[model samples]
Target: MSFHTPSDMKLICGNRNYSSWSLRAWLTLRKAGIDPELIVLPMDTPEFEERIAGYSPTRRVPVLWMGEEYVWDSLAIAETVSERYADSRLWPADSRLRALGRAMAAEMHSGFAALREELPMNCRARQRRLTCSDNAQSDVQRVSELWQTARQQSGSSTWLLGDFSIADAMFAPVAVRFNAYALDLPVPAQAYVAHWLADADLQEWMSLANKEAWIIEHEEVGE
Candidate 1:
């Protein structure tokens, strides 16, 4: 029943093609050059519940197993990694920029409900010309505004922060979602998404996602 491994570090998540939260944690760890052994579970299966129940109290994916210790939420996993590797600048080194990144990350973690609900992450899909609600459009604009403001406030960088911080990880899934749904983003947000998609590690994750066989019924939207 234990997703726990003898290895000190492991990441337990669901199918890469459909799990946005899992992608967040996985991308963060990969960005930090920490390749934790990944345990992927098939969604909508009793086996998934039985296995993940051991690592997660919330009965969810993206649980980080640090040997006997485990971290359950994606944000918590990012924070744990950041704290463990402070010198790695998981958060920006500049205090002001760090605060701003945290704020953005927190917003990504909790807000954008409409955008998320409307455009669920589907890595294999090449959907285009999809209809979106006003609320979803507003959510997209808010994300664009946040990215534009973060870039303006921090000057120039590929990531939201001046460097690749946890903030980038927080928004990585959004980039994938936008790309998957063919959502047109504003200039700043478009550039941000482009930069992340070009990342080698992210490309690798997407490659793996494309190879997965199991499909979640809910994630197979719009045919």
Candidate 2:
């Protein structure tokens, strides 16, 4: 009956293979060093819809169940935890950096529709030259600009805003899209994607995804 944990937290997520939203929330939690009870639900599993009812009224994955409050949606959960744990550096420390970070993250949450539709996340798929449509290409260009500007503005830190903040979590799906579709990137975007691809959490997530037996036919790319 309770997804909330004793003190840390509990995060209910969807299958690693297709749940981009879940990845966003999970990355934020992992970055914050809050070990939540991770419960993975298969996207197409009839049980998934029924099971998620425990997390929130929305019956969606990436729901964070805290002590007394429940947060639905990936971005909302990220903000909630950030408010609770500032030491986690969920948002950029500086006001300007935070503003820019929110702008970029908002783009990630709301934009890139074409790219997302074209290149759904498939961790096991080895797509060396998957071609995206023109709309998807435009999305890629915009994403590349975002990466370059954020990386340039961040002073000494290695992440988007000098530290691995919510900005990085926001663009996590874009990184997957580029890798999934094998989209060619400019120098700066390519470098940023490279580091993101090599991330341990991403690697582990992909590895686990590859082993999953479940698959939603709609999300599967045409071979």
Candidate 3:
């Protein structure tokens, strides 16, 4: 399938209040300045399958429907947008930086299972003093170290791997989760989280997320 008008491109997403993956894809599109039509649907509902079957084989949120072709998976969606809009600087400009950023994003896309399980992405909820499992703490430690390391490597840029790229989009949800759960981070990671929270784009998304009334039961943490 081929894309025609910008209006023809659609982003099929799920509940903004709970879907981390959706947020990743949506942020990537936004970073690329591609504002496609957003198609949101209720998740964990009986009609969810019927609603999303046409958009994704996996029946997942964040299916980028580019007229004739649809891309599922947040990482894949980010890659597609980067390739389609090379001028957008979705990835870093330097080849080595770009490669490293991709590695970080890829690791984020595939790892951090413990963190995800213990602290699901709850944008509107803040839970302080929740006990973390050893595994979860380990995951958090790794994340903090990675953030500090990336910042050091970035050399004066506020964003990871220097400049706002797909890697930042990938880690955006983690920043949200850290803030929501009151997870402790080292000075560097804490600063990185602050940067993400201070972003205008993230603030906009948070505003929309705050307006969402749908609450997924399992996603609510420390309640």
Task: Tell me the tens digit of each residue's lDDT in model 3 across 15-102.
Answer: 7877889989988877777667888888998777898987888988889987798889999989898889647488877888788888
Each model's C-alpha lDDT?
0.84, 0.80, 0.84
| Candidate 1 overall lDDT versus native | 0.84
Show pairs that collide, candidate 2. none
Off by over 4 Å in 3: 1-5
Candidate 3, run of 10 with poorest lDDT: 1-10
Residue-level lDDT tens digits of model 2 in 146-217: 888887887632578887888898888778766766667898787777778898877878888889888788
lDDT of 2: 0.80
RMSD list, candidates in order: 3.8, 3.6, 3.2
Regions more than 4 Å wrong, model 2:
1-8
Candidate 3 Cα deviation (angstroms), residue 14: 1.4
How far is 11's C-alpha from truth in model 3 (Å)?
A: 0.5
Candidate 1 least-lDDT 10 residues: 1-10
For the record, the alpha-carbon RMSD of candidate 3 to the native fold, in angstroms, is: 3.2
Question: TM-score for model 3?
Answer: 0.94
